[model samples]
Target: MPEPLDAALTKVRELLLDPNLTRAVAAGRRRGQRPSVVRAELRPVVLKAGRRLQISTSDGSRPYTRNVAPGTEAGAAVDALLAEPFGNWHVETADATLQLRVTKSGEAQLHRAAADRAGAEPSGHDRTKDYLLDPGDPIFAEIGGSAAKRRQVDAFLRALAATLPDELSGPLRVVDLGCGNAYLTFAAYRYLAQRGVDVELVGVDVREDQRRRNTELAERLGWADRVSFVAGTIADAVVEPAPDLVLALHACDTATDEALARAVRWRSRWVLAAPCCHHDIAAQLRTRPAPPPYDLLTRQGILRERFADVLTDALRAGLLRLHGYRTEVVEFVDSRHTPRNLLIRARRTDGTATGQQRAEYRDLVDQWQVRPRLARLLTEDAPGG
Candidate 1:
């Protein structure tokens, strides 16, 4: 294609090879990689882990690369590549002898300024990304531990991006239900605001302590004007004028259901929840063991946990589907610090469901004697759902 910068690139290292370093390098070159800038004659494929690339340089020798080691660091490198979704790149001539790099002076200044402000002298703005990302919004970076993990995060982000209204014109109205400590809430606020999207966010949680701390955090981050905190049940939170987006991350037990119910009541267009605790089903299972079919499976402890998780989420998806929503269940994190590791992402859709879904949901609950938290949450108000 065309080399945009004067700096020549050596063989590119796959983030799959060393994600940390690759991410560092990418962060270093972040300014130059902006949409209006980044010019490169580097013919490369952004692969999953190790990048698979073929470039013919001026030497007339085809540049072929592979990161066969595929170790832990390699996986991280891949994640880095995934993290950087905006890298303006292209190839050189057909012969592809020379690789070109284009970086703008303007972009360079931003990185330097950030590094200087952060007091990270030698670390370079490149290496200081972790320091920077963690202080404010670290959602994308923290989602995955390796290349594979990042791929999952990428999918979730993609789903969210797609479901959003194409025209993000006015300020966003967001409600983060059960927003304990409000990590994700704060991250979302920072992200939307940085992207130049106006946002008004409210974090709702039952814990008074979390609300107090989060309020203090909003003030400390200077986001008090853009974000607020409410201490109470997510169901009781006053979501004035409704919300465009509702996020309930790792809300324990029926709290996720409560958040969804509120979102549906408000007719929220977008909803995301990482649910914890399937205790409702486990509790039901304790009362009634099971019939013959389920008896074979519920006999094992590990199977029971796995089954409980699947059953609980399946019911949730069904419930959402019944309410004209598209839903998906996926892993949130591999960390053991918390047991609520699955994310249930749902977006409002116009598609009508097939009849089997409702029947299947009923059958599963009946067979397992599991009364879902969702069923209880919506029972009083949701008709035919």
Candidate 2:
């Protein structure tokens, strides 16, 4: 109702129109108002014609999604949503994150942080952040295929930022289990280092050749001391002093379980994992009969495969919750770049799981008639197991 409130709404409109917008979330209904669609989200998508804004809303039961072309059409849609009784708004762009909260008196409080900043050359030229990585970056030149990889990195970093601790007093310790070529590994290190964070990063890969190559690359980049590599399996990787953050991108099948289990064992503060395939659950679904009424869910091979992916990640998040972690499953990238875009981001809550949580997890497994690899790993490693 005041300047802050009006200015905040104006900024929200500007964000909706900004081409660099990554994602925006509007949540929390104002007091005395009950909104059907409690949460609304906006993100960019690639279309055959051009880039469009994808709008998704949830009514606490199901989600409705649609896309609108960028420009006046998107602005109109955003105006309608902003006129709703939402009390909170969060926006992420290429350069920063902005949060606006409305108080009971209708006063808006706004906070802004430059989470992602562009780099500049000594010659007074700015290094363009096409995604998050500059196209002329040496890392891309070394790896090849800069455009797609940059988008993937940008998406992954967005998810990572959700779980990163706010109070970072000391150096951040990180481990990338099954890091393969370590594209995300290097990207994480570079991004954090740019933000003035002291990072000690380790990348673990099963292939000795990969470890050597990545280690060499780190040295060439003058990051040999901050970033290193080890040759080991995700479960067997020996990382001393543990890690504050764990990253496992596209670890195939149950290997994701190993990485997650290892992170729990280390009591890592944060974790971001993007799973590649769901063969373990898919294989089990093939042999087991689907639960009653839900049989149609698995009637087709393609549908069964897709359902297995959802079930696998849902179970994985449930297992993480059991181990004193608050977890969320989010889209790590636009589906156009890769279908394997779902990411499991978790933070250590250090709170015990309630009996109801355990029972619900068990019920889901029983109904599905399948055993999850993550469940076995967490159980076997628990105390008295």
Highest TM-score against the true fold, candidate? 2
Candidate 2 residue-wise lDDT, 1-385, digit = tens: 3446877899878977798887777765555564556567788888898899999875532367899987788988898898987766778777777777777687787878974544533221233443554443335534554668777877877677667855567889999999999988987876676455678899999999999999877654446667899998888867887999999999999999989988998899899999989999999999988989999999999999999999999999999999999999988889887898899999999999999999999999999989999888877845310
In model 2, where do residues sit more than 4 Å from their true spots? 1-131, 381-385
Best by lDDT: 2
lDDT of 1 by residue, 1-385 (tens): 3332222222233321322221222211233232211111122345665453322111111122333334554455343443442222221222121111233432111111111223434522233243323221223322223544444344444445555666687767989898876766765664455445667899888989988988875554445666899888887866686898988877887888888888777778788888877777766776777788668677777777777777888888898888889888766655453455677778888567778988888887787777777777777765321
TM-score quality measure for candidate 2? 0.66
155: Cα error in model 1, Å: 9.6
RMSD of each: 14.5, 19.3
- Which ten contiguous residues of candidate 1 have the minimum total lDDT? 107-116
Error of 2 at 174 (Å): 0.3
Give Cα distance to truth, residue 116, candidate 1, Å. Answer: 15
